[model samples]
Target chain A: MTVVIGFEGSANKIGIGIIRDGEVLSNPRRTYITPPGEGFQPSDTARHHRSVILTVLKEALEQAGLKSSDIDCVAYTKGPGMGAPLVTVALVARTVAQLWGKPLVGVNHCIGHIEMGRLITKANNPTVLYVSGGNTQVIAYSERRYRIFGETIDIAVGNCLDRFARVIKISNDPSPGYNIEQMAKKGSQYVELPYTVKGMDVSFSGILSYIEEAANKMLGSRQCTAEDLCFSLQETVFAMLVEITERAMAHCSSQEVLIVGGVGCNLRLQEMMGVMCKERGAKLFATDERFCIDNGAMIAQAGWEMFRSGQVTELEDSWITQRYRTDEVEVTWRD
Target chain B: MTVLKRLGRRRLPIANKMAVPENDDQASKLEFSLDVPFPSARQAAVALGSLSPDREPRRGGVHKRLTLTGSVLNVKWRADEARVLRVSVNSFLDHLSLVLETMHAFSADVCEDPHVVLGHQPPSAT
Candidate 1:
C-alpha cells in the first residue's frame, strides 16, 4: 500500500495529514481566528498557512511516527478555495515532494472531503451534502462523476452563518458556527426568516439580508435575543438543505445521505438530517472534525486513490486552481 | 511600442508593448515582468505557491504567471493596454507585499533557520 502525506489550506484552516491505504494516520490542523465582528480575509488566511504549515507538518509526522523518507507521495488541495491560501499550501507540498523525491498529486478540496467521509464511515455511493464557508452543494455519484444536483446560487450556508455571527459580534475563537449551534439549543422562539430554494438550487443571501435587518432592529430596540435569531437561521437553512438533498436523493434513487464539510460537524445539522433521512427511509453518513473540516488526511486519502489509479501530476503541470469543480474530476476509483 | 517610464532609479525594465495600437480597433499587446528575490529559494517557492489561484482566467484580457528560479521569484503580466498591465501589476505587488509581510511576521515560528530571507527586501538592479 502506498503512503501519502497531504497538505490542505483551502481557507482559514491549515492542515497536514498522513494516510496509508484507507486509514488516516495523523491529521493536524490550525485555524486562523479573527476578532469579533470580522470575517476571514484571504491575505491574512494565506499568511497564517505560510507561517504554521511547517509546524503542522512536523506534528503530523510525529503523530504518525513516520520519517520524511517513509512517505511515497505528497498530495495537496488544488483548488475550489481562496486563491492565496490554496497556493501557499501547494507551494510547500511541491517543495516537499521535490526535496524528498516523491510523486505529487494535486487534489480537489471538495472531493477530498467526500472520499474521506466515505472511507471513514464506509458509505458507498451515498448522496453527499458538502457544505463549508465557500461551498454548498448536494452531489451524487453518476457516470464516473460527482454530479451536482443542487448548490448555492449566491453565498454558501456557512458564509451566511459566519456573516450573521459577525453581525451579532460573536467570538470566532472555537468557531462561529459552534457558538451559534450552542445558542440555538437555548432558543425557544422561532423568528420568521426568508427561505429560498429555486428548483434544485438554494439561495442564502436573502435569509442573510433578513437576519441582518433583524439584527439592526435588535441593536436599535433590544427586542430579541441573538439565540432566537441563531435558532431561526439554523432551522431555516438546514431545512432548505434537507429539502434539496431529499430532492437529489429522489432524483438519484439513492438511500444514503452523506454530510461532509466544516459545517458537517454541527450536531444540530446532523440531527435534522437524521430526522429527514428516517422520514425518507434513508441512512445518513457523517464525519467528525478530523475528517470534515478541511483536513489534510482527506487529501492524502484522495491522493492515495488517485495514485493507485496512476494519476501523478508532473511538476510542470502541478497547477493550482481557484474554481475547480467537483464534477470536473474523473472519479477513477469509483465504478 | 508603448514604453511606460521606469519607476525607481534602478531602471528595471517593467513593461514594453509589441507594435503600438494605431486605433481603438487595434489592440496593443504588452508584457510586463517583475523578479522578486527572497532570502532563500524555499521562500521564493512559497511566494510562487501563494499565487496558485491565479490559474483562473482574468478579466480585461490580462495574463499573469508566477514562477521561481532559485531564490528569485518572477512575475509576468500581459495585457492589451498599458493601463490594464499597470493595474494588474499593482494588484499583484499589493498581494506580494502582504505575503512577504506575513512571511516575515511568522518566519521565526515556522522556519528553523533564523537567517532565512522571509522579509521583503528591495528589488535589485540586476
Candidate 2:
C-alpha cells in the first residue's frame, strides 16, 4: 500500500488529501472566505493560505492515521493560480518532501479534476467540460492529449459568476456559485443579455459589462429584484456552455460527457447539461464537492499515477510558474 | 544615525496610470507620456530626500506636483507614507489601469525604511 499526500492551495480553497493505492483514505478540505467588501486579492489570498493550509494538512494526516514518515510521496497543484498563493503551497510541499526524503509530484490542476471525474463516475472515456473561476474549456481525450475543442477566450465562467454576484451585491458566503444558483432559482423572467460566441471561443467580458449596466439601471428604477437578474444571467450563460458542450461532443463523436471544476457544483448547470447529454445519448458525470471544487484528493490520485511512472520533480527543478498551459503537461499513464 | 548609501540614477518609462479613490465612483486620473522617462525608485527616493524638509517625516499624505508635462507619476501618500503609484500604458488601457490600481493598493503598506534600496537601478545621466 503506497501512501501519497496531496496539497491543493489553488484559488480560494486549501485542500489536503491522503491516498493509498488509487483509493482516497481522507479527503479533508478548508476554504477561506474573502473578507466582506474585498474581492480576491493575491496578498490576502497568500496570507490566508499560509494560515490554514498546514492545519488542513494536519487534519488529513490525523484522519488517515499516518505520520509524515508514513507518506512515501507528496504532490501539489503546481500552477494556474495566483502567484503569491501558488508560492505558499509550493514552498510547503517542497519542504515536506525534502524533510521526508520523498519524491515530489507537481500535478496539473485541470487534469486533476478530469481524473477525479473518471474515478468518481467510473467513466472509461468522456468529453470533459471544465468550467471554473479561472478556466473554461471543452476538452476531449485524443492522441494522448486532452484537446481543447472550445473555451472562453477572455474571463472564465466562474469568474463571470463571481463578478456578477458582486454587481448584484450578493453575499459571497458559502460559495459564490451556490449563491448565484439560489438567486437564479428565485428568478422567473429571462432578461435579454448579450449573447456573444465566436466559433468555438466565447467572450464574457462584454456580457459582464452589459449585465452590470442592466442591473444598475434596474436598481435605479427599482424595477427588478436582484434574484431576477441573477436568474436571467445564469440562464443566458449556462445555455451558452450547454450549447458548446453539445457541439464539442458531436464534433468529437464521443457519447460520454464529464463536467468538472468549481462551477460543476452548480446544480442548475448540471441539470441543464444532464438534459443535453440525455437528448444526445451522452452521459454527463460530475464529481462531488470533494473533488469538483479545489481539493487535494484528486491531486494525490493523479500524483500516484505519475509517481508509479517515475515522474517526479527534483529540488533543482522546483520553481513556481504562474501560468502553466494545460496542454503543456505530458500525460504519463501506467497500464 | 548611519548615513544611507546612495545609488546612481536610472530612468524607466512610466507606462500607465491607475486611480483608487475613497469612494467607488470618485477617482483621480493621471496620464503618462512616452516623451518623459520617469526616475527609478532609487532616484525618486534620492530626489525626494533632497527636496523634502529635513525635519522628521510628518504623518500625513504628501501631495507633490511633478515638474514634467504630458505625464506625471501619481503617488498617493497616506499616513506620511507613499501608498500608491500609478503608471499609464497605451495598450489595454482599462485593464492596465485596474492592474496598476491593484498594484498600488498591494504596495501601500509595503514602503518602509526608505534608505534601503528596493532593487531599482539608479538613473543614468540624460
Candidate 3:
C-alpha cells in the first residue's frame, strides 16, 4: 500500500492530506481570510500557509494515525498559482522528503482537482468545468491529455464573484463567493449584467465592472439592493459557465460533466449545470468542499498515481512555477 | 547575532546561500531578519523582486537574500559591520514599504476601481 502525504498551499488555502492506495486517510485544510473589502494578495497568503503548514501536517498525521516514517512519499502542488505560496509548500515538501528519505512528486494543481473529482464521483472520461479564483476552463480528456476546450479571457468566474462581494464590504470568512451565493438567494430583482461568451472562452471583468458601477449608481438612488446585484451576478456568470460547458459537451459528445475547484462548490452553478446536463440527457459529477477546494488529499491522490507510474521529481528540479498549464503535464498514469 | 553566526557556520547549498565576509575586526556577524506577510505569495514575490535587483554582483561584505516562504517576505541580511547591515536593511525596508504602499494604493484607487479590472491592467502598472 503506497501511502503518500500531499502539501497544498497554492493560494489562500493551506491543506495537508494523506492518502493510501486510492483511499483518503486524512485531509486537513486552512484558508486565510483578509478583512472586508480586501482581496487576497499572494505574499500574505504564503505567510499564512507557512505559519499553519506544520500544524496542519501534524494534525493530518495524527488523524491518519501514521508516523512520518510510515509515509512512502511526499507530494506538493507545483502550480499555475501564486509563486510564493507554491514555493512555501514546496519547501516543506522538500524538507519532509529529505528528512524521511522518501521520493517527491510535484503534482499539477489542475490535475489534482480532476483526479480527486474522478476518485470521489467515479465519473470516467467526463467533460470538466474547472473554475476557481485564478482559473476558469472547460476541459475534457482527449488522447491522454486533459484538453482545454474553453477558458476565460479575463478574470476568473470566482474572482468576479469575490470582487463583487468586496464592492459591498461583505465578510470574507468562509469566502466572499459563499456570502454572495447566500445574498443571491434573497434577491427579488434580477438586475441585468453583461453576459459575455466569446467562442470557447468567457470574460467576467466586463461584467464585474458593469455590476460595480450598477451597484454604485443603483444603490445611490435606492433602485437596487446588494442582494439584487448578487443575484444578477450569480445568474449571469453561472449562465455563461453553463453555456461554455454545454458547448464543450456538445463538441466532445460526452455524457458526463465533472465540476472541480473552489468555485465548483457553488450550488447555483451545480444546479444550472445540472439543468443543462438533464436537458441533454447527460450526467453531472461533483464533489463537496473537502475535495473541491485546494486540499492535500487531491494532490496526494494525483501524486500517488504519478508515483505508481514512476514519475518522481528529482530534488534539484522541484522548483515551483507560476504558469504550469493543465495540459503541460504528460499524463503517464492515464491511457 | 547568535542566529547570524550559526547561519554563517552552516554550509548552505551554493544555489541557496551566499557568503558574507568578516573584515579584519573579526566582528560578530551583524544580521537583520524581517518577516512581512502579504495577502498572497505573489505579492511577497513582487516585493522581493523590487529588492532583488540590487543584490546582483554580491561582492560586498554585506549579504542579503529576499526569500518568500509561503506568502511572507523573509528579508535575511548579514554583514561584518552593524552600520552596513543597518543601511542595507533600511534600504530594503524602504523598497518594501514602497512596494506595499503602491500595491495598496493600486488596490484602493485604480485596481479595485471599476475601470481597472475591466481592462488588462497589470498590478505593477496600477
Q: Rank the candidates by TM-score, best first.
A: 1, 3, 2
Off by over 4 Å in 2: B1-126
In angstroms, the error of model 1 at A140 is 0.7
A163, model 2: CA deviation in Å? 0.7
Compared with the true structure, what per-residue lDDT tens digits does model 1 show for residues A1-335? Answer: 78999999998999999999887789999999999999889878887886787789889989999877789999998888887788778766766665455899999999999999999999988999999888999999989899999999999999999999999998887889989999999887888988899999999999999999998987478677888889999999999999999999999889999999989999999999999999989999998877888898999999999999989987767777888999999999888
Chain A of candidate 1 gets a TM-score of 0.98
Could you give the CAPRI-style class of model 2?
incorrect
Q: Pairing residues by index, what is the TM-score of model 1? A: 0.80
- Better by lDDT, candidate 2 or 1: 1
Per-residue CA lDDT of model 1 for B19-93, tens digit only, reads 444445554567677776555677667667654444535567788877777877777776777887776776566
Name the DockQ score for candidate 2.
0.02
Q: Superposing all C-alpha atoms, what RMSD in Å does each candidate have to the true structure?
A: 6.8, 14.3, 14.1
- Give the TM-score (vs. native) of candidate 3: 0.76
| Every candidate's chain B TM-score | 0.66, 0.22, 0.59
TM-score per prediction, in order, is 0.80, 0.72, 0.76
Docking class of 3: incorrect
Q: For residues A211-300, what per-residue lDDT tens digits would candidate 2 score against the true structure?
A: 899988986897887888888888888889998888888898989988999999888889999999889888888877778998999889
- Compared with the true structure, what per-residue lDDT tens digits does model 2 show for residues B1-126? 010112112334434433334533333423222222322443333222222211112332323332333222343222222242221122112222322222222222224435432323333443
Interface quality of candidate 3 as DockQ: 0.03
